[model samples]
Target: MTRKKNSGDFLKECMADALFILLRTKSIEEITVSEITALANVSRITYYRNFTSKEKVIEFKLDKLISQWIHEHPRKESASAYESSLSFFQFFYSIHDIVQTLIRANLSVMLLNRLILKFHDFNTPDRNEYYRQIFISFGLCGIILTWMDNGMKESPEQMAETVSRRFFPQPEP
Candidate 1:
């Protein structure tokens, strides 16, 4: 199916595009609701109704984008565990823009913090889980940045294979 230039998705793309445009020229703190609304051609009423702050836009969009990416390219449940695990890199290819936006806003840390909170098993993060999330978050961010920095020269399939070979070596047989 094709995405069109009307309806809810269109409006979201417009708002996100506007935000990205504004983001390129100014820090999120310096950018205003009015500026985003004006650039988006979306009314202030709508913007305020959907977003409470500029950071909220990044939070909302990045979360939605990553979730959508994962849903669209989900790991095949029946695949071998190793193949399913490699499916993770497929997600990075799909979220380039949103990831870059988070980095540009200096909000990748916030995104990592949010992910840790979301994945916690209980009210409090156990020391083990906390450190696990911290390690994974930093490691994943490094992978994403390095991939981008290298201009995404490797295809997602290549990245997945490289990651599996480099990080998930098979047990000696």
Candidate 2:
């Protein structure tokens, strides 16, 4: 027996597929909600119910990816700064393709700024912590953009190692 499809799930799948197609063919600025709905074979109402705007859809995808990363790499009880950096780099590497597309679409800078602010809000408890978080997030965005601009030649692991050395230098044993 075949299971019935849920309306919400169906709409999400349609949106995902449509976004993938859009990424390949056209700039985000050139795409419209009607076009997305047409490609997804869904009504405009369904699309509106699911997402307020195309940008929201992209935000939702990024948020989901970040949540998955947090789940996959929970902060250890004794997690050091390097471990935290590595965990984030791993997550970034996993979603590199989607990220590259966002970068190509000129959305990465805005997204990165928002993400850094979010991280600062979440991790910073006091004034000092706030500054530290802001600094780290800002620096991380620079490193990530550099990697993307350089065609991502090195593996994420190698990039993480470089970041670790630069930001969280190891002490001589």
Candidate 3:
């Protein structure tokens, strides 16, 4: 038997859809919770129950997308940085539509902030290691933003190879 979505779950999905639809034409700041609820056909109470603000809705959707990617692509036993970077670009390529939309909507910072939070090692007490993780996260975000800005014409494989060559240039024969 198939499980049915609970009311809150259904409402959250509606709100997210409404937000995305509105975002297509309106900036996030211009979107009000009332507008979201009205468009979603949900109640103000329902919106507040699921999200704190309009930005939270975007954050929720971003987290959902990232979670889906992580589930679909399990990490290797000992994946190299290049392998990870390939997967990274591949994931963005798969979601390029939404990525582009977010970029156009000027909400890409939410994506960057989310990435930084995901890469954060709360358990690590070493400052240098923490800094390294932040640096990598920022670097990846920069690459994605640039790619989206440039229309993302290159294939994910090409982007991955370019990044690899940049850091590990081949010596002249």
Q: Pick the candidate with the highest TM-score.
A: 3
Residue 19 error, candidate 1, Å: 0.6
Tens-place lDDT digits, model 1, residues 33-144? 8888898989989787777777777666666666665576664656753474456566666667666666777766766655544433443458876677567666665776
Residue lDDT tens for model 2, 32-86: 8888889989889988888987887777666666666667777687876667777
* Stretch of 10 with least lDDT, candidate 1: 116-125
Best by lDDT: 3
What's the distance in Å from true for residue 54, model 3?
A: 0.2
Candidate 2: minimum summed lDDT over ten consecutive residues — where? Answer: 1-10
Order of the predicted models by lDDT, top scorer first: 3, 2, 1
Clash pairs, model 3 backbone: none
lDDT of 3 by residue, 10-62 (tens): 67878988999898898988988999999999889989888988888988878
TM-score, cand. 2 vs. native: 0.83
C-alpha lDDT of residue 47 in model 1: 86
**Cα deviation of 128, candidate 3, in Å:** 1.9
Ranking by TM-score: 3, 2, 1
